[model samples]
Target: MTENDSSAPAPDRAPALPPVADRAAFEAELDALRVREKAHTREGDAIAAARRRLPMVEVDAGLELTGPDGPVTLLDAFEGRRQLIAYYFMWHEGHDAAGQCEGCTWVTNQVRELSFLHSRDITYAVFCQGPYEESRRYREFMGWDMRWYSALPSNNELLTGRQVGSMHIVCYVRDGDRVYETYWTTLRGVEVMDYNYALMDMTVYGRQELWEDSPSGWPQTMDAPPEHPMRTNGRPIPQWSRIEAGRSDDLTPGP
Candidate 1:
């Protein structure tokens, strides 16, 4: 049957499976695939090594940012660490939390731990592209306890010729009182912030996103009724959990 016809009527039921093979033949094919997997892992390591060696650019360390504790310098966000990784969280001015960027939420939600980064003399924080009061409420609503700062007033200085109000992952290095931009990535490059996508890659059906090239009869409804893989109830899939848990989606003006 075709992929569209293969989807089970119920979500709990299994869809379709790949062709069956003899035990020895299956093992032999898997062994060959394992070799390719190892090579892919090695190449990833090589790419990371190359990324580490890229030259950095100096940024104004005195750029202003607003946090829960009020105004702070960009250097201060580093929190006395040797390195800093800041996520440029996109925002919709005056909109409620539900209207915020889904792509940003999808990735940022995975960054729940920072102790490991601290162990490596690194600090991680979010440089939100809106008012601190509104965005921080969204952060609390989503149950994220990470350090967050509003970069709205200083986006020009921080982004420096790049597009502002867009999601970006920027790496920085501290040299005494000076700060330098080591690397910055956006779009698919920022997928590193996603654990769900990484885990989905290991599954048989994969992410089931429309763009993915899956085997015939694969159980993916990408772009059919759902359209995007990240949405379900007219909102990002993650927001549903918060909504179900009775979290407020309001970040509108005046509380």
Candidate 2:
């Protein structure tokens, strides 16, 4: 058959396909899975409840971070809000935009429309591991308007025992002038910022990443190793659109 023909599988390789079933059979299978889905959702809610109850640790309110207006403290970053969600963005110092962290770009680009969090009296910001001026240019290139700051100077104190240079989400709450860290997560935990992965999980192909437990012949094009799955053509997938749209990817400070 020709490549366009869908009637038969190619002789060289078996096409990946899900087993076909009648509507009744499909509904029966779906209903069975729905029970587990509901349970998973409820368990998630319970876990969130537990997270809310977890005790917080005190962090120095005077910890310095470099913002647009120069030096600002951790307390200042909250912008007078009672709560804060800080994404500790990984950075590759001295590298151009394309050489920066792809995983960080994957999650950070998804964070738009912060009014929902602001409505709840929460502030969201990025604490980048690179210098403010250089990284701020990156933020502009990526079209991010949410607050951005350089956490490099305060990295030793802020990250402390945690691994530096890794992507992290840290939750904080303040009372008067005292700041406390309520929760923190890294690696796949940062997936909370991603809607793409969540939606892909519901699709038949499911992320197309090699790490998943997909059946034989299922397309797993997102393989990794020297490069990340979130990247395409040497840059993060999202950067391509911005570059194509004539946006500058230069991280150098403008005059």
Candidate 3:
């Protein structure tokens, strides 16, 4: 109503619009996102590369393994299965089958059915690191019929590198008469096959990782620290090889 007020520009005029985002700014933001994403993808690729470099080990391919019927070879144990996944069960004798490996048996027990593996033309077996005579009874007691063979008298065949700990997944792809070690994983990769821990964590505890998705104060069994400046080695601490030859006195019955 006042003359001065009328002269002023309409108060309702929309505020000056924000400057249009620069292409560089937009692209830079996108680039940052991509960097995070690609880092993850590249990390996976790097892992696969390291596994590929694990080196191939050649065995006699002629050694005999006592199957249900009789002696067999490393190849015969495959039985024409296109793929083979073997778990190296650690045993050094004097431990008895009951104590072969509480950890290894824990995993084997979860294997629901080999029928699925059979259908896929893949053979799943376990290789014992001890003498056949010492391990066969242990296998029997565990009630596992999965194809098992002894890796005794280690020749060139690939060794289960379990110096610190032994749970591993070794994949083999057979081509004609040759067998190749394809892909192998030791850490969370093996956890993919783990059923119990995953289920229980969700129901109550939550994944025992540091950045858990649960509310504050949740119970966590594994308290591994973050990998920033403090690297988390994860489960299965490093172990000494069979060279130690545990003392017989170590086996004394608990008082």
TM-score each candidate.
Answer: 0.91, 0.92, 0.56
**Residue 85 error, candidate 3, Å:** 1.0
Taking the tens digit of each residue's C-alpha lDDT, what string does model 2 give over 221-243?
54244348887656787787778
RMSD (Cα, Å) of model 3: 18.6
Off by over 4 Å in 2: 1-15, 223-227
Ranked candidates (TM-score, high to low): 2, 1, 3
lDDT tens digits, residues 1-255, model 1? 222232325456466888899999999999999999999999999999999999999999999999878899999999999999999999998887667888888888999888999999999999999998999988988889999999988998899878898889999999999999999998788899888888988898898776789887776654325334565546665776677678888886454
Ranking by lDDT: 2, 1, 3
Pairs of colliding residues, candidate 3: 163-239, 164-238, 164-239, 201-206
Better of 1 and 2 by lDDT: 2
The ten-residue window of minimal lDDT in model 3 covers 234-243
Cα-lDDT of candidate 2: 0.89
Evaluation by TM-score, superior candidate among 1 and 2: 2
- Top candidate by lDDT: 2
Instruction: Report the Cα RMSD per candidate.
Output: 4.4, 4.7, 18.6
Model 3, residue 90: displacement in angstroms? 0.9
Which 10-residue span in candidate 1 carries the lowest summed lDDT?
Answer: 1-10
